[model samples]
Target: MNYLAHLFLAKDTPESLIGNLLGDFAKGSVKFLYTEEIRKGIELHRSVDTYTDSHPIFRASKRLIAQPRRKFSGILVDVFYDHFLARHWSEYSDVALEAFSSHVYKILVDNQAILPTSLLQIIPMMKAYDLLASYQEIGGIDNALRRIATRIRWQNNLADGIEDLIANYQQLEADFCAFFPELIDYAQTYCYQADRPLA
Candidate 1:
């Protein structure tokens, strides 16, 4: 999952949303810095990433990519899944994607002072570009991957690797359709079992 999915999975609180978004930057034991609810959101973010990486269905999706681009398949698939989630947002939730996107952007922007240092730098760009609303288009995925490629340490080929996603688009959508519902269920159950909020 990526930013939108993490936010979608977060409990409806400013702190929880901030914590979930912080997962990308706050590695290791750093989540302990937050309140219990925020910590739960951070923990949920890691759990979702671990679950997505290990699931047989997600692994199957990664295998569909060509061998040459296989090394970056996980990153590609994560973005691809968000595209599907945005495209099919109406089917999954009653809230319109545009409205939800605006809401999340407001939450992040309004609470900027509380955000992790890394996220504070990125959130402005995300809101300015309207990333969540743009995910319905393949071009958005391409642009996002290319931007990611420039930031990474390695000689990542993500700029050209969007083709892998374009080529296997249908199968990847099917895979996301199959996997996301299960993931939502798992996340809900996890939060419930942990005595944390799910919405």
Candidate 2:
């Protein structure tokens, strides 16, 4: 699944209704994806008092969790999808919207237990049905999802706002800038767009 689908499924489907659906799907895809192990690692990392002598996955999870800025960036994406995308479903194509929605619902159903609480809360409040029912929409859902995901990616890059200074200080300024022009653009766009206080 694309990042948008992953985000929507991981964070936007209704928990009560999709619980069983997720379980069935998880039996197949979840194992293949090692999602359970990844989730366990993520959980272990979140608990600060836990020792890091467990395993490789646990250690990686701890590192990921230690980067709180990334976590916050994920939260911002969740907020945008829940508050904006879900409310404007009518503006999307029926086939694309349904396909995207079904994909998201299935994934949520499959990974219901491991999903973060920040994600679960967004699910029950989705306005997909209301949006879909009223309008004979066209291609907007795909566009919107893509746009939001791009915005999230950009925000994540900008979360490390000292990129130029770091590159220069590290004596790889030319090489770093040459290798990451898009990343630089993402950071710039994110800085321009973000309204909330950055961490």
Clashes of 2: 3
Best by TM-score: 1
User: Residue 33: error of model 1 in Å?
Assistant: 1.8
Question: What TM-score does structure 1 among the candidates reach?
Answer: 0.93
lDDT (Cα) of model 1: 0.84
Candidate 1, residues 11-118: lDDT per residue as tens digits?
778777877887887778854477777777888899899999999999999898788778988888888898999999998889898888888889888987667787
lDDT of 2 at 199: 17
TM-score computed on alpha carbons, candidate 2: 0.25
Candidate 2, residue 15: Cα displacement in angstroms equals: 17
Candidate 2 lDDT over 24-138, as tens digits, reads 2233233343343343222222221122123332233223322444444333222222323333444422445556656655555466576646446544533344322212222
Error of 1 at 24 (Å): 1.1
For residue 49, model 2's alpha carbon misses the true position, in angstroms, by: 30
